[model samples]
Target chain A: MRVSLKTVLTLTTLFFISACGADDAADSMWRKLPLNNTVLLTLPHGKVVIELAPQFSPKNTAQFSKLTQQGFYDGTKFYRVIDGFVAQAGPKDGSKKDLSVPILAMEADFKVAKDWAYTPVQQQGLFAQQTGFKDGFAIAYQQGKSPNSGKAWLTHCPGTIAMARNNAADSASSHFYIVIGQAPRYLDRIMTIYGRVVHGMQHVQAIQRTAVIEGEYAVDHRDFTEIVSMQLMSDVAKAEQIHIEVENTESKAFAERLVKRRNRDSAFFYNKPPPVLDVCQIPIRSRIVK
Target chain B: MRVSLKTVLTLTTLFFISACGADDAADSMWRKLPLNNTVLLTLPHGKVVIELAPQFSPKNTAQFSKLTQQGFYDGTKFYRVIDGFVAQAGPKDGSKKDLSVPILAMEADFKVAKDWAYTPVQQQGLFAQQTGFKDGFAIAYQQGKSPNSGKAWLTHCPGTIAMARNNAADSASSHFYIVIGQAPRYLDRIMTIYGRVVHGMQHVQAIQRTAVIEGEYAVDHRDFTEIVSMQLMSDVAKAEQIHIEVENTESKAFAERLVKRRNRDSAFFYNKPPPVLDVCQIPIRSRIVK
Candidate 1:
């Protein structure tokens, strides 16, 4: 989600103003809470909306908060666009010298055995607190490892938001990227992932692709889809009215749907795939009822 | 690789005239070969130089031949533009009326143990028979069950030409799609594999993406990247001089590169991945050496 710092500030102010109430306080708080917070990303062609998934990736949400509070991603553009691969974005500082705020590298959430064992068998509507989100921010959790080893991270699936790194490990600060094609799992732990473009991905994907720039071989020159403005829905009075829900992962209906796609037992398949599902391949769509 | 048909026709004519040796009596026979041996596809965004891969898929090639000869794809436009999936083109005849050509659905290419294996154990490259060039078309054997079992076909890797089919068994014709991202393996045998894009895939990818049209849910509008024209590079004077070479699949260098990528032993990889390589995940980079 391409957010402008102005919107973040507006939401902060609104949050404080609404908190000043009493009699209708609880109701007002719930009503003012962000619901189907949608961000409209304007591209050279058109716009696409991304609904954030906050339940899954709280850390990612927190990082997004920090970055926006500092106005870190305000003027940045998508700099890398590799066909069939990904489109990356980040701070304009190629040398890490221009960072406006303090930056840090995030840890990895590799799906190792112990990690997998600790990963609760996914349940419908039951939030899995590692690298998952309500919108498009990167996320992770503390599940298994040593006492301090239960850590999670944002994944590099399509539409993911990650920080760009230099040769050194802690080089990532204000840069980021969005996966536009096949999942680039190769970049799993090398960079810091913060969020993703949950709503305006089509707008991000439709940017005019160009040859790689000279100095930054990994970056592209296509003008990024413009950001009219991105704000937290909690800042707006109408935020309370919008509600959206994701299909419960552990539900029977969702299980059947996944089974059909993963195995293709339908007459259509002459050969069935192995009973394995790549977490990234699963689709998480959001919609509003009434 | 977007070819300007007009330019190619001019180049083909000039080359044909020049290639006719004055000393050979057979030159007279060759001179009679019509310049109409090529087909030009004009798109709005840019040009795509498609040398129909007929020899790779004789039946499908013949189908294309019949369609092009009849100017079936003349006014048609690219319809589908999935950001990371594919960009579909061909006759937008949603009725599936293009299936009039006589080629039945063939089994998937899993029969040939050595040639069709997806596991990394088997070697892979552009070495399928019934494989040859039709004019400038790069084609392979079109495999059928009965008399056509051993036949070859054009692999649908990227920049492929294919017949669009519905859920039915043998429905495909008119509508075709060019893969703009990773190869869509699921559609392999379900539709007839025909040819590939020889050049100008960027032009195809640059086409604007839009919501599927009203009646034809599969097709987008004609707001495609403009194609200056599409003609064979072979027909141009310096086309032969433009020397290029694909990495030999049997070479030790190719195997070593694959192994390195599969394991990610490079400094770039901080962790080790499972030693598995999906066939379609490989990268094939092309360059103009000379």
Candidate 2:
């Protein structure tokens, strides 16, 4: 809307998003990810850190980890980048068979168990009965936690990293994609999600987009975004490493944060929307800690 | 997914999205827009055609047309652009007072009349009981056609053009914004949506964005995208004119099209999603006609 700089300015002043109250970001409320499982993917523009969701898709993340450790992803180019769809990267097309690594079985979704835990966004979705967060990952699942009563899978939210495959359900290899636009809920259980970008998403957004003519397979050979390297965080020198901490989704403070956002007490929202929020729309806080 | 070029190629082969079955795109199924109410907004890269929704917000569109005729939008810079939010432009900050145009009273929403017309998506939305397309524009509204039973408003879908305003309910003068990313349904009845971009959304996506710090009003001056001109189609020279025809949302052909897309009966979709589509996600067909 016109004169919205003032509005956005007001929002910025009211909520210092980056500097969330020091208490909220305190050590106890935030959880550190396992360095060995985390990836530091360096693009030409900047570095993007991806936290692998091994618990959800062990096979996919394992194969990705193996590929990264072997330097298979170094010099890989983001060959397919649709502005509002996905940014995919890996060895060139048809080259996966040449590598010694075996194609991993798809872990696109799993049956919800009795002990299945998640920070519920508690909103009904077009694709799933319930949508929410699990260990800091956006996900959708069938309602009811009764063992094997429902299925659960990571959602295709922006910055999501999922394994790419062909017609065959389990035909995925090292090639993967990052969700770059609106949440494509249709691909939820069909594609396996391995990880998510926890930092430097702006650089990922800045990735040079390839020309895509809607349904046409028009591949123009131009300067594509290249992957300089993909390394495990633990491998980097201590001084050069950038440690990260994500807000514990299950924490009381995080729940309060969600409630506060759901209830927009701001005068600007004269016509307040329903208390429910879209799972994919909520921003889960993450930060780089010294 | 990997080998997706082949997948996308298959989809292109199966369904030419642009070249829908000739019968589906026939004149009977397509509705022509009034030339005088249509606008051709030219940018540095290309042109974006916008069709004004005068029925919904007459005052707002009238003011915009008057401003366009006065050459008010030419050479304006998209001074504030958030990648996943909005691309705004006009006479710059604190410049609305310099214009002679009066602030149009807000027409953000209206109560549904007995004859309230819409091509019902028949899908529930996060913000309303129903969401759908009305005269080719995405919208959300309270359910029921009974006169004055509920409210309806244009949604903030990608490519939507809405008037920007401050705290005052009717303070919008000239500056406006275009939704560029995920549909922020939360803004439904808060801002006046007078028009929508029917064509050249890609060019708008290619606009240069300003750097923004999360929740911080740190504006770094960069090569901001500029507006060359915005003119009503009727005022354009005959040779330069590009006539547009949109698929009649109320037509049976359009309803069938929606069903086909909603069903997604493809081999790629091993597990189909619910037989429902998000109102903001549906692509209303528009074509250039001689």
Candidate 3:
């Protein structure tokens, strides 16, 4: 069941060029723009393409680089899989035995605007600015108080990569999880979030619950299943290039799309819901846009 | 191993009593004054304590009662368990070749006021009403539009009991699901939602994924886990004696608590977030405050 990075790239490339057409093909050239900052998150089902937001947390991004280089996460398993909340993974090195090393903390991501509904831009498949990379970090911004003093932070949107922490102020380290549900900003400033999964999140979503040890409740045992190994997409073959086009965060099509979905203008819905969109509710679709 | 309903009710009583205390106990008593309309929800882990929201959806509630009387969902198993999205169940009979009846549609729950939030009315363990049940239907009153005119749909907070349907509206008949994570409003108007899980939701959450088919993802003919059976809490012992108290929807404590949590004055949070609480984001805590 293990999928190789090379195979994925090839399938992705074929999917994009053949399905997305030529104009998109020309725009897809942006992929060639040096992905040195890219990090390949290998999950059991597929790989997560992460564009590190270094600008948001310079130190954290550097740490991530060092950790990836050192292969710290190479063998970690995805330990927690909450249907829609998150899929937690990393050293599953039992916290009880590993509390000695203090967890690290990072600052919040940059903000874009407060109460900003959404403004579409030139991109085709991108969402909010939080949809893209900031150096190595992926984030979203919202105006809080003054129009100019809007703040930015890591959104708990699906596929978000975040550092795990204990119940302390500045506690979070390599242990991470991807948001699989509604954004849990309740954990916002309390935890240090670092990156986001740009592609292949479905693979993580479809992983079967393995090595489950029944406790008082069915909490995943750290020792149950281990992440066999991991590799980066950049190092994979050309045929395996995954042509992903995010919903342009700043595109007019995007905003209208949100409004459309919220109201469900499609024939599918008989009732119209009050128009509102939670940050996490926004979907960032990835198709083969080679 | 599947736990018994009696043990579950006993354990939950302990859980609630331990999780709450004193002056709060008395006030909760006030809020729980008259127990006219009640509903029972059974799960694998144990029996959940729930009261129907007769006010939100009278038609839906009536349909649910009619279906229950016919034992439509008695032997059904929970088919889907998305950690933070929902734990779905209902008529396992639908896909069975022996059965042909379709799912039924239910009306939406009422909306809550924007100004009101669920908080401790008398004690920390008890949360005030973010939404309340009227005539056995889940309803809320938020700030904005008319107190009654504002969109009032089922609050998809955790433990919400809803009916499942096909692509067409009004298709729901026997299938149902429970909210296990943050509310998924995307499914709001699209589906026939009925009631909220009054109790035993944890049991629903704890069910082990078994040999049932994963629909589109089933590898071969391999089966996924299926629910052995489902019973109403009223059918179990101790479930009758279960004293449940909901937070008063019209309480000032609910408003303040929402603001406090939204802002996070506690040291645990280093950054305070915007004070906007979505209708679904409000937490409504229930306890056996006898």
Candidate 4:
């Protein structure tokens, strides 16, 4: 179900050209993200901008916002970095006991209704009945369920941000992880995914992976990637504030882009395989609103 | 499609215990990999052992072997490393013109026969009609084709090694790249996959990523990760040669492992979603032959 190349070109031209002036279509497709719901995570390499998905996990988002305002993560270190898995960061100390905030209830945030206007890439998924995108987040839903009763959850694709938990479901307090490699979809519907890295994923990948000794990632706290600071975009000074805009997932341009990706007929490809698409492969373009 | 866990455990116990005395099944499933088809790649951090898949891509494997024996990649720097995509190395000057070996023909080795004795993981894939494993290599094939008629190619899973080429398919020569993050399945049937990292993948992940500027990785050839030496295992002395063995994909133990991954009912998982297995997620356990 790929869109034609001609349609993609036409849409791209019309969208950018109209965006230069004033067009409702363009405006609707490329709206500025709310500053209050965004976080600027500063690393040694660069700043990683994340747009919180409060709509998916409201409780966890609120908890994160509160912590950001209190400068809780100012000097925290990315303690556990497993190569091809995740880069985790939280308090300098391993224990979550000293945290001021109470433990937030575990929010599996797995599903929304089937009629939620998601652009489904496949009717079947490795972990769910169907896989798609919702508000720029990779998601999956159960099959054979009624349209009004179906459930969906975020897939753990690269750049996905989720709260790290212990054995218990409600153990998540302050620790969080950003997926840096292949999508660990097995974690879907099992963890609370509240945000995603909209920009500066290269910095995330730049973080040094903990050394492996006998097949286990050695935990050396002293060599961890230090977090300079984590602050809400709204809390930053007016001149220093960073603005971002993500391409609307429901927009025509997005649909066109999906089609182009599914059936890439570019000169780069010698043999064009089928137009099949993975939910994780779908691009959610995010740019600084300079 | 999944082998039962009870069966796997039983087979493991019986195989190991009986094999200590005498067992044909154990001998067949745990055969040692040929040292001639294995490469020992030395990095600053550690040694990465890759087993060449000559059966899948004979020409590329042969070319790679010849290059290794000649020490062409001994001092080459990992010139173009894109985080979460590929770590490309070979030819410090970024040109293949000076290589002694003639460029091999582009091997799209995408498909084998339906009766190739591959263990199927999924009937459908993001890039191919069916996906499975052949000799521990992730592979894909077209559907409904006769046993000897269908095509199958190696998938670009993490740790996959393929030739780096220019716009032309046959341009690949001395340069090669290794997939480091999510499986870039799109590269399947487009690049010539010759080998896979059977052990010391941590060393590959440990390589520092060159800083990216304006969404492009900064190419500072002088600061690249250097290859100490690249040699075929057979070329090394008997005492220094690293003996390796990979889990047999066709064995009953592999089936059980697949089932365990597909339906993880472990105590750690709070909410066990329906088990769906991605072909890339399946483990082809490789260990030093003690």
Instruction: Indicate the docking level reached by candidate 3.
Output: incorrect
Worst 10 residues of 4 chain A by lDDT: A18-27
What is the per-residue lDDT of model 4 for residues B115-221, given as tens digits with 9 covering 90 to 100?
45566666544466667666778888775445567777888988999998877889888889998777878788889999999887767876656645343345576
**DockQ (0 to 1) for model 3:** 0.12
* 1 versus 3: better TM-score goes to: 1
Instruction: Please report, as a residue range, the 10-residue window in candidate 3 chain B with the lowest summed lDDT.
Output: B120-129
Residues B106-192, model 2: lDDT tens digits: 898888865565656643445677676777888776755555687788888888999988877778889899987777777778899
Scanning candidate 3 chain A in windows of ten residues, the lowest lDDT window is A120-129
By summed lDDT, the worst window of 10 consecutive residues in model 2 chain A runs over A13-22
Chain B TM-score, candidate 2?
Answer: 0.85
- Candidate order by decreasing TM-score: 4, 2, 1, 3
lDDT of each: 0.45, 0.74, 0.49, 0.75
Ranking by lDDT: 4, 2, 3, 1
lDDT of 3 by residue, B1-290 (tens): 11234543443343233323323432332256234345555543455555665565666666666666556666565666544456666545436621455345557544555432222211110111223333223444333445544444555655677776665777766667776555665565456566665444445555543322222233231232344433343443564455556654334444334445545567666554433334444545455554
Clashing pairs in 2: A1-B164, A2-B164, A164-B1, A164-B2, A165-B1, A165-B2
What is the two-chain DockQ of model 2? 0.19
Residue-wise C-alpha lDDT for candidate 1, range B1-290, written one tens digit per residue: 11234543443343333233223432221111122333345566544545454434556556666666655666555556665457776554544644455544542342332233111221112123222222222223434556534443334565666766666656554566777654454455455666555444555666655543222234335465333333333343454332222333333344345556655666655554333343444544433343
- DockQ scores for all predicted structures: 0.08, 0.19, 0.12, 0.28
Error of 2 at A10 (Å): 31
Q: A-chain TM-score in candidate 3?
A: 0.66
